[model samples]
Target: MNAAANAPRKLPGPVRAVGRRLPRMPASIAFATALNLTLRRKFPADVLDRLEGHTFAIVVEDAGVELLFRVRARRFVPVAQAAEPVLRFRAVAWDYATLAAREADPDTLFFNRRLLVEGDTEIALLVKNTLDTIDIPRTRGILRRVLRAAAPGGG
Candidate 1:
């Protein structure tokens, strides 16, 4: 047996102890930080300023994946676990990836309900509209700049 399989596993709580793996906080945190920067440039300061104290949960239902992101004091904070999100959005991972990469139309999925949102409908709609209005090339340029800054000699 592999060394990991032979070890006594510790169960934290109600959740099952799926095999333990190295934590990926660095990449996730980086992604969230980059995403926040993109949001700031794409959206008005007042709109983003009002996002404080709201919890958003993005779920990839088919994959049984969940990511909890909370807006606290005008910053996006990733939570280990969250209960009763103020907003929940479910979508296929590919669709979201495509949208994020600027390869797909966010409106098509939203109109077809492939991208589902629950709770705080008005705010959600506003977010969707804002995302739709973003100029893909400009957004990509900003993101590329951010990536370059993150890496030494990356540009």
Candidate 2:
């Protein structure tokens, strides 16, 4: 691989500059949308259908952002206010990424208290069990390919 390809990329000037002006809500919504889309593709529809009307929050501590999503309209949608989320999960950004990237296991993380979940235990268990069956790295790879193809010059 080229050394250029190995180097880390800084955010484009426009993105970094606009990042300040852009509100948090949209980014959260977009993230939830991407996750929902990926999950829908990877899992059975009935599984996600069960989430309808339920509210869940994923808090990325390092990013200083919490994404609250309500299952509605047959899809997960981000909401600015959820009086009380049925389930809330919190983890540092890198830790969460490692879990999602399959570099770390969820059970291991939970056992080590690296991943914390709050609220309805039964619901949390249900979500956790469902997620455990998923091949996160594979799903993430596919999502990345789709996104890159959609980006300028990615083809």
Best by lDDT: 2
lDDT string, candidate 2, 22-103, tens digits: 5668877898788776775665577677777999888765455677888776677888877899999987655655456554
Candidate 1 residue lDDT tens string, 19-130: 1232434434654686677665566666676677777787655444566777766567776666778888887554555466555566666666767888998888777777
Clashing pairs in 2: none
Which run of 10 residues does model 1 get worst, by summed lDDT?
1-10
Clashes per prediction?
A: 0, 0
Question: What clash pairs does model 1 have?
Answer: none
- Displacement of residue 69 (Cα, Å) in model 2 is 0.8
RMSD of candidate 1 to the true fold? 11.6
lDDT of 1 at 132: 73
lDDT of each: 0.61, 0.68
What TM-score fits each model? 0.63, 0.70
User: Model 2 off-target regions past 4 Å?
Assistant: 1-22, 136-155
After superposition on all C-alphas, the RMSD of every candidate to the true structure, in Å, is 11.6, 7.1
